[model samples]
Target chain A: MTRLTRSAALGAVGMLAASAPAFAQSIDEKVNEAFANSTGWFVSFIFSPFPGTTFPWIVMWLVVAATVFTLYFGFVQFRTFGHAIRLVRGDYSDPNDAGEVSHFQALATALSGTVGLGNIAGVAVAVGIGGPGATFWMILAGLLGMASKFTECTLGVKYRNEYADGTVSGGPMYYMTKGFAERGLPGGRFLAILFSIFCILGALGGGNMFQANQAHAQLTNVVGDYPGWITGVIFAGIVFAVIVGGLKSIAKVTEKVVPIMGVMYVATAVVILIMNADMIGWAFGQIFAGAFTGLGVAGGMVGALIQGFKRAAFSNEAGVGSAAIAHSAVRTKEPITEGFVSLLEPFIDTVVICTMTALVIIITQQLIIDETTGLYMLNEAGTAIATVDGNSGVALTSAAFSSAFGWFQYVLALAVILFAFSTMISWSYYGLKAWTYLFGEGKTTELVFKVIFCIFVVIGAAASLGPVIDFSDAAIFAMAVVNIFALYFLMPIVRGELGSYLDRLQSGKIKKYN
Target chain B: MPSKIVVGFDGSESAKRALDFAVAQAKAKGAGIVIAHVLEWSPYSFLTPTELEERHKRRGEELARAETALLKPVVDSLKDSGVEVSTALKYGHIAETLASVTKAESASQIVIGRTGHSSLSSRLFGSVAGSLAQAAPVPVTIVP
Candidate 1:
């Protein structure tokens, strides 16, 4: 009787295994549908092309905001550039007096948030689709976006909520509610709620999913192809333990690891550029020539502009209001001082870091530039360079790394995994804040969001990159839509704060400690 | 006063014992008492920007609480003890910072409570008593 029962159980297990693929495929389809539906509307709304142009309205939306802020503030990003460096250097800080965060700390945290997959995978995507010309527009956007960062971060600190328990919760939502009310404007709460919704979605899609998917993609480069869900589950387990299980030591480890890896990544790029020193000028020529003449790419300069601005905003998070959240916790009586420090973020992320990544990809000649036409060369099949590795984003970047060092893909994989993990944790914090804002802060309420976030890590890791990129782009850009809207009316208050800070500095009321 | 005695205080029972011991020493030596409260702060400690900002407020509150609830009452209790009393509050590594204050305030000696804080940490990172003994500018007395 025991033998017969065991044989019957084995038969049943075999039958289930035979049907598992069909069952899993159906569940996968349902998940894809649900996920696509979750963010499709917002993505479409933000990414829809403007009338009679190939450009997305969202691109124009951010460019115009950055330009206006730069002009209105009298090009503050450039004028205050040196002073911004001094602030980060603590030239004005009194070490004896306790400030909540050093200027460098605030800037470092904010930079860590913006400088991850977006610089690696996202830049590859831009340079791939928009060509080397995208680098020109990216640097341009980074400069102007500094002004946008300044306006929002100043408002973030000024209107930040300081609770009785000494907890701080500030971002576009807090600033929206308070700044709007202070200005006696309508729809403050409505806009705040709207911004929170976008922020939560953005954090989940762009911040969480994109990081997971790209990390898994890089993992596949080192270890041969396997089911993404397998890697996703492993990532999810550790991430859950860290974020949900309150494993802070791992987060701290990553905090130190990410910055060190970032520096190493940049230094490697600098070495590669130095090794191929002669190609540096030619690479710049490619960037410049490609920017105007379109270099046989479709939509000419406008296409590059759209990709450049979009990825710049995506990479630096300058206009996304996420930096404002990170910077708001800065210890400063003068809110504008934090703003000055914040300008470094875009410069570093886009102008310095992203430019390094772009130049490496360019000088490596992986994109296969046509010397005669000064255009990006398509394969014999006429497909773009994205097809080189069957995976464009990080793969294109990996290909470039291998072109120089051959074994560099291993290092790239490590950096990508660390970067992706660190980014996921950072985004989890951002999502948690937005979640608690929408749903009142409670232990149970927070647990729900944390669990949900970990689950998405698996989903992101399993899914293909296309939908993830779309959802991520849309959600993050949607945040910009609401945040930049708030910045428009709120600029006057920031200007007032800046004026007072400058007057005090000039009069020696605010001493320069160094 | 011709001399000063620096007492490390953290509102712990052991710390109170140290303060009492310090009071006795000050009286015996005709010295003043300087209460020092050192907060453990490291710039390298990894923290979110939000946590860092919120912590700054708690640091201020912690100082205020030490001043009123911890230091003031001690000063009052010793008002008639004919010993000069003052407080020095700072944020830094506990043992090294206390030692630095001993040097900064020109104290003759230091008195601190022997704490039973995490034997595991003590084994790994060394106890505050051990650090103070090694780093103090003058003699250190660890009151039982």
Candidate 2:
């Protein structure tokens, strides 16, 4: 059986590679054009500006929700951060608790979904457009976003459906519906359905396509440009195999992949930062100065804040309510413990990892700031920019790292691909949960969604960035729009859960076996 | 009506030794012997609904296999013996499950093998025998 499985896997890879060239350039262009045209209207509307202001209202929707949750919880994210670490360490877990995965495994699985290309490429984009000051706002946003995660995840576990078979299904869909019912609130069902719809779309767009798209870009940057469909086919096959094997397979892979990729990426960044240790102080000064004074970048302080907040939301996904789905699976009778553990996701993904990427870019002097004007140099299109081989995003990050070590681009490429792969695997699960919730749970329904999701891997790879980014942003932000509403109503429940858990913990009623 | 002694059995050499020790103790005390085999099964958070469903089916199969293939033969051979013998199969943390089975059976003491599979993991996390010694409700005897 092992030999047969191995051969089958090898055959799939061989078939993918053998069929690559058949995907013509014209077809790629057509797919890209079709996506751009079809998705433009919805994308523009979802990201439409607030009345008489340039700011995207969806971004503000997330920011305001995060800030409010932060204050409402009395900064639970900070106060419980240590306890959260202990929970993940299985210190507070009862071996007899009726749940599927361990706290650490759930945290790892959720982290895999969030800590992807956003850390590598998105940070560069934020730094590019918003300038170094964007890093400041990004960190701030990540800190506030932790509170949002804590609230949604606590409610997620509180209202989760535990089956007789010991399986669990939870997320915004369950919490929004069941939680609202418990509170005697109307429209719980409607809100849940809305959240599910957005989650499914978000899974397809941000989770699958955006990852496939970025992975393709990174691969092409390392190797010569090949058709995106080739990358898509290979990724689709691997992803399908893991997802079909179900959550255990996905978790097993992510548990290993997330740690390795995170360590490798962070370690490389640390080495680079230390190599240029002399400039570390200067980089912080630049970030702080640019944050307030705009550093002469286009749009200045406001632009930096918007980009920082947007990308931080995109990267950590705290308010989007997806991580709650992952965290809810942890084995704990005390629902608030999972929430506490989940607050660490944004801190690790955005504050630590994203900041590392941003610092590397700033310290390396990659943004080409004009000394006299105190402004970032503009590209041919009149946009503030940084580039290597006319490549930006992950490529720009690659360039920054490669400056310290010439061979670093190769490592960055591999890390990007792994990050992309792990993210896709995790998102597939998140998307599947949402899919099952909406379509109803059955083998045929699940297979249909899984097949469609795999097909989107191809579409994501083949499609151009314009539509992919638009769709990803719209779907994710739409989830926040629905989720934050439920959170506003449900914060009291989370607060209660937190208060009781903390009281028990303080009173020494909650025993720590480990 | 006689006292019962629980023996942790897994069909390994050391487990056979532990079983022999339990039998000797039972014979001396005029007690009965309950053979208990625990399959280490920890819940994973990463399983999907479908996988979880499938896992439950697999768990049943595993328990059945352990009963028929491992425990039944031993129980059958001991059936004719004068000392009373029974069997149990459970899925969970080995030491805790054994301790629970001992408590359930009202057994006076528990006997287990010093596991041969000691590695870095055992050193870091401690072995089942070591944990059993600490957490087991009854006195535990480790047969080397």
Best by DockQ: 1
Report the number of the highest-TM-score candidate.
2
Location of the lowest summed lDDT over 10 successive residues in candidate 2 chain B: B44-53
- Candidate 2 CAPRI grade: incorrect
Residues A309-338, candidate 2, lDDT per residue (tens digit)? 989999999889998887776657788888
lDDT of 1 by residue, A1-514 (tens): 1336634643554455456756644654666677777767867877999888667988889999999999999899998999999988878876565435678777777777888988988888888877889899999999999999999988888888888877777888998999999999999889888888888888889888899889878876775555555556667877887877777667777788788988988998999999999999999998898788767654667777777888999999888888888887777778899999998899988999899989999898777656786567655544344344444788888888778888889989888988888778777887888888899989999999989888898788777887889999999988999999999989999888888888887898987877
Model 2 misplaced regions, further than 4 Å: A1-23, A97-100, A245-251, B1-8, B25-144
The i-RMS of every model, in angstroms, reads 2.8, 5.2
TM-score of each: 0.85, 0.86
**Pick by lDDT: which candidate is best?**
2
* Candidate 2 lDDT over residue span B69-142, tens digit each: 99999998787677899887876788888998898899999999987778999999899899999878888999
Q: What's the DockQ of model 1? A: 0.32
Worst 10 residues of 1 chain A by lDDT: A1-10
